[model samples]
Target: MKLEQVSETTWAIVDASTYGNVGCIKLPKSVIVIDTGMTPPLAKKFRKLIHKEVGEPITDVILTHYHSDHVFGTQVFQDCTLIASSAMAAIYPELLNNRWSPEGIQELKEYYVQNDPAFAEQLKDLRIITPTQTFEDSMTLGKENEVHIQHTGGHTAGHSTVYLNTERVLFAGDLVFCQQYPYAGDQTNNPLEWMRAFEEILKMPVEIIVPGHGPLCGKEEIQIQLAYFKKLETWIKAQLSEEISLEKVLQTVDSSPTPPYDLKADPRLKFSIERWYTFYSQDEG
Candidate 1:
């Protein structure tokens, strides 16, 4: 497994193409894993990587959400408690059973075959897990070191973030994507509600952020993302007040408020824009 040392205590084994991002957080009581990459087979290999890095077994596996990429690989650890948000555990089975998402998934499968054929073979029969223990708000793991996992679902209904209080590192799941546009195509996506969720994340006192898809970033990057979301909300509110048609909003708004939003250049932007118009207007009415 290719590992990137994101911070002092956090390491990311990222899926370069698509469908993977597994992080390991070393806490005082024990090492707590953030996400479980692709499948049970990959999870076994991930164990070796973790043992090599921390020289200890993963005491806990905390899944940030129920998306296929993040939660499929939970069988590697021998003696660890698997965790998922209460909301995630509730709806996880449905997402796993329906395997029609070839677009995002193909990216990872193609890459894994070339880089790690053994792992690709292992991901063949996937195992989806329900949280052994569930929490409504925030939860902590490895109390000696203090890893505070904050639960704020958006992007997916049970998405979560993990924080190391001493290290001040946050493992932000699908709540924020790095270079590409976020997928808000699910039935659970609520654009305006997601906007409110972003507000809560901005209030976190964090120094370093390990996003679900990209490299670790600073608090300033978080501010920029928050600002982008704030602009989106304001723009939507203005359109509603002006009594403008949803079509106009869809045309005017691009990927984001900034110049590079380039709705025409990226196909994914259409879905995001449509989601915004449909969701917010319904809320307004």
Candidate 2:
């Protein structure tokens, strides 16, 4: 876990030891945290770090999406005003009653216990904290409204990006994966919306970008992701025209594209391909 001062007013945990990056925007009297870490303990430690480093009381926490990696640690900010997109907030009830329920959490812990015992330990006393405030499309925070958060569904239906108008920094939460293959297997992931989100980010005068994961970057990275997704869309459509079985299509396009990205061994590669294949298949049907 490394904390980097992205700008005069913004700081980010770019190299998360667990998963998902976290960021905060320091205001005159308060600080607004962008997504907590992957677990309760991690977020608790991060909250303490923010208070010590930023020297301001945390007033609000903005959730970029509903993924466990980005949201499960929200319990640390229960005292603050937790905010999320309306689409994201709506899913919390179902997630709480189902995937985040005690039984569901135990099942998750059991799975992790086999794979990552340390992480499973972190989930021991985990608690689910839902957003207290919701936004429709876009909203602004800060005394001068310098913080702009907009819902740009792509990676997930409720995914959003936070931009600092004055600092020229963009906190691209999972919308931009710096160097690795993104997890596009989410049920709500949409290639088209993802591309549009990239386009929207390009339009901003962003000097720095704090991606949801990986090192800090700029618009160049966004362009690369956009181009990659466009190529993926084209390839998927071409494959569909052949009317071949989905299995055959997957087998034929097993190799990852190179010029832009070479994430052939990335675990999410095949999963993303399959999800995109299913999405296009259903659309064409």
Q: Report the C-alpha lDDT of model 1 over 67-96, residue by residue, as the tens digit.
A: 767777775553678877788787855644
- Full-model lDDT for every candidate: 0.69, 0.86
Instruction: Please give, for residues 162-262, the per-residue lDDT of candidate 2 as tens digits.
Output: 99999899999999888877779888788888888888778879999999988999899989888888878888777778787778866766543642467
Which candidate ranks first by TM-score, i.e. highest? 2
Q: Estimate candidate 2's RMSD in Å.
A: 1.6
lDDT of model 2 at position 114: 97
Identify the candidate with maximal lDDT. 2
Model 2: number of clashes? Answer: 0
Q: After superposition, how far is residue 142 of candidate 2 from its true place, in Å?
A: 1.2
| Poorest lDDT segment (10 consecutive residues) of candidate 2 | 252-261
